[model samples]
Target: MNGTGNIVALKPFPDAARLELDDAQLRTNLRRATHTIRDKRLRVVGEVDDWEQLRLSGAAIKDDVLARLPELLERFEEAATKAGAVVHWARDSAEACEIVTALVKETAAREVVKVKSMATQEIGLNEALEAAGIAATETDLAELIVQLAEDTPSHILVPAIHYNRSQIREIFLSKMPGVTRGLTDEPRALAEAARKHLRAKFLTATVGISGANFAIADTGTLVVVESEGNGRMCLTLPQTLISVVGIEKILPDFSSLDVFLQLLPRSSTGERMNPYTSMWTGVTPGDGPQTTHIVLIDNGRTATLSDEVGRQALRCIRCSACLNVCPVYERVGGHAYGSVYPGPIGAILSPQMTGDGANKTLPYASTLCGACFDACPVRINIPEVLVHLRQKGPKSRAEHAAFASISWIMRDRRRYAAALRAARRGSAPLRGRGPLRRLPWPASAWTVSRDLPLPPKESFREWWAKR
Candidate 1:
């Protein structure tokens, strides 16, 4: 399942970032979008007087859920089943995919409409469904664009964030069936076109699949908060409905929504609240889908939970506030991280979710600016986790040797003075040179985009002795 998932980074983050950085247009798009969202979030978040207290409460709730996860999961299953939902457990991605595909096939449907779901993406569910001859159509406007363009999602909340209006117009005109050639790049026109395109799918699709923003163990309710009504349609309009949820998504009770429902929308879309918040309890017989299934997927979550510091990543509500504020994410974009979940969260989450074999370099992809933790609604200390994960990674021989030499020198006064004297002599020629140009190998890497200031002409000990 890990092998089959989208968590694997095809290349190391540095190499991927190097390639992504060359795209000026991409950088421009990312800067505009992230800044807009960042400014909006700051404004709305400021409106709440007790925002910090709310963040603390949200984190405490999620931590408690993780601590009692085993019991909470069972309670959720029991309550969901009692409410007429068929709850299924999946140990990994493969099992989750198999379970969903089988459920879809049981409805005798060739096509299924979907609400945007990170868990489904994590399992590579669409690709798996395709292999089984079932078409999983993404009904969300942004997801549909990415799917039509054969592109992976670059951002958590805005999947098509990398694409500008003109590019989106081109995609719709070229890829969308029955779309008018005159479709303009205006936001309204694009929304209209997508709405018309998805309307038929929503009406006729026999199966719908979704991921929950929250699953309440107390009442067996699954909640999805979105700006568009597509999620509501998916929740209501189908012969059968299935939801793929991560075990971490569960809350101890229905009241937990009071905190998250407030935090998620504001932190994600910069909205005081989402326009559409859809909740369902299993099935409603003739009113909605007759058959309801909930597949709770582990897929290495247990492994992630094993970590003391890293377990905090599971608290992510997918608000993506961190992505909108991250400097590295703004410049290089999400594709560089090579995961559906990107930015500060992905750098920590993706590595622990899969293993050391995949995304080995992700932990290093940060400035440790601490912006992410500040933006996080649940207050995941992402930089702390990133540093923790970095410590767990394979040590660099050159770095280890360099630190070892420094340690050895610091332990003895003679070596320290000798090292200082050598440095002073080597830097004398470059003194008052402002900043040295790119130096030779090893040091060249640091000097490429940064200045290397010349050291003092004499060591402190030498100056004292001469005086």
Candidate 2:
């Protein structure tokens, strides 16, 4: 994972152009994945009579935690250290990468097995490790697929949701050694092949790197919740375990853990309870890892927190429920967002963390339909934040100058009416059943997809006056 600042600097234009061309395949993959998870989520959530109340509680708890993040982080550091875990604080991505790289180098390990950790992806840890001549293997199934394909994750929970079965089979045949050449697109065959490939790495690796779903400040316990048992294996099998987590992931106590444990699984994978929920407080004698280190990263999170409207994005648990429900994401897919965090969350989050320059186009990608807000378990008001970012966009000096000229012409009734009349006249040559056939430059981008309505023969004000 690269820093949010650098990662967000790479916007959707180049990626989106490619994704839009793959519309059919994206639709098929998104329809299959989203429909399955959406149905499961609704069923499990409906089982709880007070689902709305639980959502409210989750939102309130996160808000309270964010309000006191600095204090809670200090408390977490104290507690973790007391439990024999070395705590490292990183102010940015470069520092975090440097710390992790140095630690891995100290162990003199060339290869490390990894559990699926979004924090690692957020910082481009694998790439950083590779740059330092260390090999980081992703053991999680979806993450493995992503790594093998040399593609970025499309969804938070299901990194390969954009890939169909055939695509996956092709990836395996090309990447995995000893994989059956005649593999079909069956789920069982694919899973078996991945299992076989990862087993060797698990047994041989001396060090493991992971990201925690939550870090408890009270007892200094780190929690990882997952559907697969791979995380459990990675945490325990290695002599050295390094967990890199976002500063925002800290919870006040085990009591607070009860709320997230219940909410996260159901919201994310639509599971009643996660199959593997691993919790460890430092290191145990002759058990798991003899050495444990926790790296708390604050890469762009503090900057995002400084903005009142954007702060709510920090509460995201990466459930990706919002992603599954997002219409734009369903169509364009995650790669188009050009960030580790994609979909609805990425749209608002990327621009704010990176600032509104070229990346400013992301927030405008959505229709502001508020579907993401409804689907988010923590109740992040995505639509509000998106609109807030849009307001920030036109205020840029370059943007203001462009719109300012247009504003001047549209200010007076006569000038506006004349402009509309001119538009109607110009569109005469493009007369069709619907609207104008073609538009100029940047505006043509919008017209390429759907027809732009031509100006009416008369303004509404003129009709009203006549009446």
Candidate 3:
């Protein structure tokens, strides 16, 4: 959702994907980045002797959380309140944004520093804050790059994964104010430039906005795992901190962090452990934020939770492993999906979380490759959920009529034989050849990158009768 109660999609997947496929640079960047991460993840994941068992444990813990979501949310609110953090519940993205905007206004701060937050992005919090005349500065290096370039994130973990070093250097030189001339495209140089740009914002901003990787119900703690120190700065430096988290991100207790912390870093950044792991419970007197607020955002998660089969998507940990391993995402990149979340996980979760309007096409974005399922640290059966969403989703009149016709023809033996006879005659020109390079209108979409198997000259029924 785009924080306005709207399902955000500029166009269907096929249309956006077609445009993205034509971008040679995007395809090249995605191929290189995803493969590098995929190889590294495989190497690190191989180092764990009990990886599969850990995945099972993670999935079980998440399932239990989903099953007991309501109870846990109340428990979390009570604990956070007791710990001096005000807890607010938002029924949707609009309400969440409203609550956060009001909270920032109360701090009387016209500017806010932000950590890398998928939840905020999902609800368009930056735009909301911008409308309120509050400037939200992204402190994370990749997020800063994306913000400077005025682009949406294409990858979950790495917001600027679509850009190469040279591209980033160009963005910083042009968009980042006061950048020195002749800046190099070296990784260290780009990082140093970003660090300098964000350091001032971190020190001056009074309010910070963030999303949690996990929210522990037992202690009302929020956990953020990151490779850079930016998250730490955002968490501690601000006087007023407001965290907007999804309800599904909640876990039963602090112990559950044992399994997820191990799973998240390995799957996301391909590290055995993140460089920085920050956990905050309510307000810590004179330590972190003096005033703390936790906004628990439902934002259609309850609807997603209502679906028996689709609810499995709630088990996601935002690791981005599914994206790195997905062939379709590798080709099209994240912008084509047109959501804050993208890749295989987005293919299923987007439709369910926002309902099957513009995002219904996402369910069909995959080749049904099981790589995403295999790569998921929590073992969320993504392929199964994709198929389930498609089966239960809307269909165009043409698709409905075509299926109806096929079913009618198949129901009668005589009609079925006649259909096969017509098919052989219709396919006669291509019968002796290899896979057809192209087909007519509706089937043309399928044959664009693939070849269809030519129909046989004779039906099996006809051959049997003749023999």
Best by TM-score: 1
TM-score of each: 0.96, 0.90, 0.95
Candidate 1, run of 10 with poorest lDDT: 1-10
lDDT per residue, candidate 3, 1-467, as tens digits?
32223336668998999999999999899999999999999999999999999999999999999889889999998888888899998988888999999999998999999999888998889999999999999888999999989899999999999999999999999999889777899999888898888888888888988999998889989999988899999899989999999999999999898899889999999999989999999988879899999999888787788889988999999999999999999999999888888999998878888854468789989999899999999998999999998999887898889899999999999999898889878888766678889888899867987888866887787789999
Instruction: Please say which candidate is ahead in TM-score: 1 or 2.
Output: 1
Best by lDDT: 1
How far off is residue 393 in model 1, in Å? 1.0
- The RMSD of every model to the true structure, in order and in angstroms, is 1.9, 3.0, 2.2
Model 2 residue runs over 4 Å out of place are 1-6, 9-11, 394-433, 441-451, 455-467
lDDT of 2 by residue, 20-41 (tens): 6577977888888998999899
| Candidate 1 per-residue lDDT over residues 227-306, each given as its tens digit | 89999899898878999999999999988888998899999999999899988897776788888999999887888899
- TM match of model 2 to true structure: 0.90
How many residue pairs clash per model? 0, 5, 0
Whole-model lDDT values for every prediction = 0.91, 0.85, 0.89
